[model samples]
Target: MSNLDSQTAYWDTAATTKTFTHPLHAPWLDDVNRHAAILDYGCGYGRTMEALAQQGFDNLSGVDTSPGMITQARALHPTMRFAVLDTPPTLARPDASILFAVLTCIPSNHAQKRLIAELSRVLKPGGTLYLSDLLIQDDERNRDRYARFAEHHDAYGVFETGDGAVCRHHPSDWFPSLLADFENIDTRRITVATMNGHESAGIQILARRPSQAQVGPVDSFTAGLEDR
Candidate 1:
């Protein structure tokens, strides 16, 4: 199977049965316009989008790789929009969007980088990307798994959970590097509850795409990617 399918396989069957609890901080959405286009990439069960809708924001679209999750989302929010996003990971929406808790679900380093590049492509100039993800934990249980997983995965912070889902935890410096293309607004460290019932340190970052004037020619950016 392809990597994308491997990544999503667990969620297809387990999403509806489990719950993801990522906290959305107030500052992350402080500047989002009410009518701006928002896409919750990796939106599991439409939870965050539902929260956004309740806060008065409109024009929201949620997409997940797992059909079961989309099934749950559409059923829960009949009036809201939700769709299943399959392999190749191209979003169907127009050129700009917001992402919440997307990075955590991606367990590979290269995949995370590719997703950031894709987000840069689809996000309109000045569009904001609000992100929340787990950080490498200091606890023994997590440390042991991180070490054990190194033998199986390319990155040290990625591991499979007891429930059979693969997940990634980030190093503090890695967050800034992953979002190198975006203009950072604010970052905060917070403790969070994991989907599998654990407390872990996590991060919240709010960043903005540079306006058109701030960016150089498209070829200049694409040139750097060709070699990679």
Candidate 2:
């Protein structure tokens, strides 16, 4: 099976037995508006969405690639919106229609690029984008792991675990560069404690899409020439 297929199957099996939602989501929770639409992308088992709903955010929705998770989410939260996205997403929302998270679970840079582009297109100017994922560290252990797995890997920093599962990590500089179109509000590295008690390196970021009216230096220069 392809990596995507493998991941989907893994998550489907995991849906009934695991809860992988990160515990430290305060960065995105601080400015949440009850009236605005929020999407929990890669929302597994709808745990995060359920938490948000309990906090009084009514206009919330979620999408996941695993049907098993979607099924569990729908069963648990019958009133909330959840969709199973098995293909390239064709979200019908207008620009700036939502605030969302690009959380963990993606296994490759190509997948990350496509998702970021789609989010950028649908995110309204001034909308918030929250991202949290594994960070590439300069540790000898990580380097050794990469060296051993790079030949058979699906993407950079991605490798097959001994258990035959794919995992990916990214460099610290990756997100800020990937999100140059957005105004970064905050970024911090934190140690994530997994359910199994193993700690992992991770980073969280909060960024805002610049309003359409905000012009760059090039735009300002062109506009000045036009007025002359």
Candidate 3:
């Protein structure tokens, strides 16, 4: 099968019966302000969005690069907003935006950086950003498994996926520096048991834009001038 087809199959099978009950999901949902505009980045099959909806998130949206995934999301949650987003939109406001699990699937490091920049740009000052992605861990077995996947799939640059799908496993230490522009609120490793019953490690990142109140007068002056 082609790589994309292989990926679709993997996710379809894996996602068909999975519950959105990861430990990280609850905390991330709690962190979002009520009625906030949240984007489920790479929202495969609308699991996260559906979970958030159950928690009373009315303004939630789902964006996925995969058309099949988007189709499924729409069919399942027709009342909620689902869109195929090639890139972040020109949002009406900043601080109201939140992206979850979006950047990890991008195949280019430069593209990932640009995506982060776009997220930061459109987020309102003091807006929150939560990201979760597979991280290279210390387990030799897991490392070898990932290495084999990389080799088999010919995955390179910032992201890679083989038999599994399009996924980018970042180094554990990489996120902090990459997100240095934002206020790093919390970083932790979350171990999740996948539907297949295998445990995987991911980095959970919580960051915030510098609020207008936090920006010093000098910086605000520059920002104001730039806005003029």
Candidate 4:
């Protein structure tokens, strides 16, 4: 678990150098309390956090593995709490954690699963989990990269960008199964611009952790993470 993630170094060095434009719809979080405990686990420069703050939502916090990102986030929004994660996938928030396109930065299968498991642990039953991430595109360039890296990477959608960061775009069926631990409230497919300014397929998932009475231990879902 201590193994360094490939994206971390790239992000930290280029922290103030990039801009993220992934869409985060405010209406999706309309049901959540304005003061509910909200977390953005891989928040970049605190864009989503600021957006929620503008919506009259307070009590929001963000954590990221990149010190540069945390620094930039803190500078951008001094009122909001931001932290640098030393041992990632190990969030201390003990409700209603949220993520915005975080999975796209984590290219490996196991790393992504571990982060999801940690999210399940921190989130309270019935808490909202809003996730936005990349999706596989039908374009020839993307398909070629998927095939080119298939032999080395775990997922076909995993590919390297010209700027040298490894990124993952999920298969359509992969998300529903991966997030089986959560009850689906809504899911939407949208077109979004990547940080590099390319239009790509994206997804936004609004879900809730099942009630305690309706499910088994969070560890059970984590066990399946390992089995995969």
lDDT of candidate 1 over 1-228, digit per residue (tens):
246323666776766677667766655566566676667777778888777777677877777777888888888889988878775356676324445556666777777787777777766676677777789999999999999998888789888888777778889999889889888888888887777778889877778778762432121110000000
TM-score of model number 1: 0.88
**lDDT of every model, 2 decimals:** 0.69, 0.59, 0.54, 0.71
Worst ten in a row by lDDT for model 2: 219-228
Residue-by-residue lDDT tens digits, candidate 4, 69-181: 88888898888888887788886653345567777777777877788777776666666677878899899988999999877876698888888887788987888887888
Off by over 4 Å in 1: 1-6, 213-228
Q: Report the C-alpha displacement of residue 168, candidate 1, in angstroms.
A: 0.9
Candidate 2 lDDT over residue span 36-71, tens digit each? 667666666777666666767677667666798889
- For each candidate in turn, give its C-alpha RMSD to the true structure in angstroms: 5.8, 9.0, 8.0, 5.0
Best by lDDT: 4
Among these predictions, the greatest TM-score belongs to 4
lDDT of 3 by residue, 161-183 (tens): 33454655567667877776688
lDDT score, candidate 3, position 188: 73
lDDT of 2 at 91: 48
Off by over 4 Å in 2: 1-6, 92-104, 137-143, 154-156, 195-197, 213-228
Native-vs-model 2 lDDT?
0.59
TM-score of each: 0.88, 0.79, 0.71, 0.89
**For model 2, what is the alpha-carbon lDDT of residue 210?**
78
In order of lDDT, best first, we have: 4, 1, 2, 3
